[model samples]
Target chain A: MSDQNKSLDPRIARLELPQGESIVKPDEYWGTFEVFLQEKRGKFHQHVGSVHAPEQEMALVFAKEQYARRGKCVNMWVVKTTDIFAFQLADEDMFATTPDKQHREAGMYKVRDRIQEYQNRQK
Target chain B: MYGGGFLPEENPKKQTETVAEDPALLADFQARIDRGEKIEPHDWMPAMYRKQLIRMIEQHAHSEIIGALPEGTWITRAPGFRRKMALIAKVQDEIGHGHLLYTAAETLGKPREQMINDLLSGKSKYSNVFNYPAITWADVTVIGFLIDAAAIVNQLANSKGSYGPYCRALERICAEEAFHLKQGHDAFVYLATGTPQQHEMLQAAVNRWYKPIIHFFGPSDKESVHSEQLMRWKVKMASNDDMRNQFLDMYVPKVREVGIDFPDPNLKKDPETGKWNFSDPDWDEFYEVINGNGPCNAERLAVRKWAEQKGRWVRQALATPYTKSTVPLA
Candidate 1:
């Protein structure tokens, strides 16, 4: 119930997925495609989606082909999917959840008024 | 039996070996799951759970990142200005989806940098579909109609997953994806009903995509070692086979109605079982493609690496503390 104290830090060092035998060869396919999009030409291009492509040239080609086709874009960007970072959900309760209630939500001190009233009466 | 990557580890080798031995703790984990409470970022969790979630979330994130490739290519070449604008919006929506997913994954304790680093270093994995080259303008429609359709099926299911953050992200993403599916379908219908060349183009695109679309389900349920564990933990809302069946039921008639024929000669609907059946996907190729050996793998990776290299300056500039005096004039 008291999850308020947990904070998100987007700048932490990344985790590495152990590399195994890659499905695609280094020469055959571009590693991965990373995509970002701009709602309009002047707006910031935010990261959106990724795909595996053969090269930067190809990724850009693929990005333009795969992501910007239907009708709602002014500009688009693509990179390698391998270059981005991500997180896990299984530990959602651990790194973000806390046990003590005193620090989480402000509502934990619901009886502050009552305590102050009792002290005033005694005085 | 295996380990390493993402979060920093002292021994790296011993990281995977780190496991909670207490049965009580395991029970507590199960109890938490039962409470319908979101597992926050800083609570005790099993190592395997952490590993699995990282793998799954990273891949999902990667898929979002790469999935934007094909459509982005079509923006400049869209047959009309309206189509171009619509395509651009659709691409932006995908970017929004990535943000939602990255935020969701962050709630699980890993830093966004670490996740991105893993991807850059080739220590993380994403979906296999992006590795295929998009060869034609028609391929754009195919990707939108068929690829996004497959993704929507999966994302809709993911919307109900046990993880609160993932569920929320899926909720928003699925909404946008519905529009994407329609746009693609609309494109497909237009092309299918257009001139003979357009119809032929649609048909050829369908043939090109059918195998990849079917393969998008990942390995079949029978061969997937992690499917059972993921289901047990509610990480996976539906089995692979169930999702495949759902995709088939929704699309087979739709494909026919659009006047595009499904490529599988063996594809058939079993009235007795009320399920569609077809030749099995080549699991070996599926595994190979996902592992990073698809036709366009190297090309894709190189593009990413180069972009990252080029963007280093931008990233570094952003990382520098902002001072009002040094602010550049817009």
Candidate 2:
């Protein structure tokens, strides 16, 4: 037994570890599961965080432990991290706008003034 | 819970213009801030604003990860299954907060790996409170309740800051911290109202932690410098002294109601100013601790370094190129 382990609280020290060392394999990794939490009923699920698990069922259990232990979450979905696609930062320019688009805003119109003018003419 | 007031080093004379920007664009940016518009990642902002925000967010993220280590050690020895489960969940939430803050900081153009390297190299700073050890289980309650309360006071204000990603991150973090406060208060109440031994343990822990709790808000506003521009940009939401006073007003009565006493004999409220007044907590010691001389600074960093080194293989393996899998749900 290592000296550090001996100094740990007996409760933790007694927890068994798997026997023998395991070799790391290339191109293999613990699956990363992305967690989405639904805050309440009728609410859309939002991405919360991720956890590593060996299988989908294990991912769900781990997600519950990591993200949904609180009563705030009513539902949760766990998907592999690799499954999600995203736009690179370089593509941010595509979201830009050119020229003015004030016509799309309510403040751009003077409808209230025009309505008052029509009302006066009607009177 | 660890995102408390951060006092960057005094650099009042430091130049704010390294990368020159157009004067008209700068005026428009300041006008947008005056109108309370949030600055998104792609927005045109001064170089200094981006640098300060990155520094603040990175520090906060580091604080969360290191903050978890103290209470995390007590999980296995939490005395009961209920406490054990709660402690584990709380620590996990703190780690999650760190990841969220890292993502928010990454939006400012620094990679997460570079931030971690800065933390490992001691080029950045986290909350000084984590440098002290959680010696007893009762210390966990003190930290969870009192320290978390201090952080909420700071974070609630920062949630309204002018940075979109950081403010959004703080909004979610504040919500989770509220739950942690409840758990901490519940555990504290149990001990304070329990047997004589339990009460004694609780009191001792409180006394031991009182100084660090007071230090949690950083230096007094009068002694702080290089914060005026940051506050104007909304990178720093509130003054240090204001957050500390707010924390004391909200919590002092509760602690007294529990029949516990703070170590400071001069601790009281000023009726005229509606502010907290207490003896100085030795700013020299605060400086020393933040300079990496505190009791557990070395230990905390060593553990983090070990985790990073051991997990390198896992991170590398995960980075390997693989075909994206689509699993069907029944």
Candidate 3:
């Protein structure tokens, strides 16, 4: 409001803003939700980013504004960040299939090649 | 978006200067980085890495927020209907960028409110360029064109950085920047090739903005504390000087082709060395502006503080039992 804080832009000058310190309270930004984006009709929704909103509907709106603004996003899904179960990044090696379970892998069945060899031997 | 030149203030007591960590864990962290794996928010990391990233990302977010203020001043006065729409869209994108980045930084444990408090209280810094005013439409274009380009260079390199959340945020920010750059270039070219008065206006803007543009990347790497460990950790993807040079290399010709160039006569490429050499941009002014003494520094902070104060009721009215927020899991 004073000459000391006078701004060049008329809009700011009009606000007559007083100069001082102000603090925002914790959680003033609200809860978080992970946004999932589907680029096309047949594509699966992949997690892109998170948005802070009070509820799922507002979360979807914010997600659209944030993640889908510049890209080809056909649809979006918003779930509370708290809902997703995640494994520890350090435990990444646990997901790998052990070599002993090769029988369960389709590639491990070499029966077709073995049959070819037996047929050739019979010939 | 214009986020670097941040070497965390070094104190002899503790900083990047020295911090002892468990060697085995440090090695594993360093190895992960070396192998180009992103360090996620939940993963184990060095205290220094977390601190540095929090500072850089927070600073960047603050930059995007404040960076919009100067341009937001011009929406009513933009030359035509299309430019008005473009400017409005670009400004919104910038604010959106700030919000996205705050979330990214929050994942590192500092809450978004704390970051806002820091910004309002002047405990942190944003890009120094926003402290300057956009005196004319030409000035806004310069900011949209050159400042955005500079940010892209800084951010593109940062997108390759080892932190997962930061890299993700930068990827999104950079995507929208293309439109901002094109809109800026179109406006700038129109003025450059238009009437003599328009040409003069744009020229004056370029003359005034060149020094700040030079300062935008931060202090020279040679003058500042050497952040070798940060580079090794991928916290710093490129040196400040390197990013500055890259900007000048890409943009100088673009400016010159339009019959206007930066004011510095010493600004030229040494064909022998393939590097641009420009006069010293007066680092003291840069530091002075950063310490809150520039032309518009007071106005900028004052406006930000006022917005927060005025918006208090809305925040409170909206605050349900849900107001107890937690840091987002990335």
Question: lDDT scores for all predictions?
Answer: 0.63, 0.78, 0.87
* Tens-place lDDT digits, model 3, residues B90-111: 9999999998899999999999
lDDT by residue for model 2 over B1-330, one digit each (tens)? Answer: 764446656454553335777999889888888899888876778888898889888999999999998888899789799999989888998997887787678678775666777787777889999988887899989999999998889889989999888887788789899889999999998999999999999999999999998999888765444577778888888888888988999998888888888989899998999988899999889889888888776666766776676776755654535422222110
Which regions in candidate 3 have their CA more than 4 angstroms from the true location? A1-5, A98-123, B7-17, B223-226
lDDT of 3 at B88: 96
* CAPRI accuracy category, model 3: medium
The most accurate candidate by TM-score is 3
Q: How many backbone clashes does candidate 1 have?
A: 106
Q: State the TM-score of candidate 3 restricted to chain B.
A: 0.97
Stretches of model 1 off by over 4 angstroms after superposition:
A1-123, B1-18, B223-225, B322-330
Per-residue lDDT for A1-123 in model 2, tens only? 234423233433353432222233332334456788999999999987665555677679878876676668888898876677767644656767633677887778878889999999999
Q: Is the docking of candidate 2 incorrect, acceptable, medium or high quality?
A: incorrect
TM-score of the B chain in each candidate versus the native B chain: 0.86, 0.93, 0.97
Off by over 4 Å in 2: A1-123, B3-5, B10-21, B223-225, B322-330
Which TM-score value belongs to model 1? 0.67
Instruction: List the lowest-lDDT window of 10 residues for candidate 2 chain B.
Output: B321-330
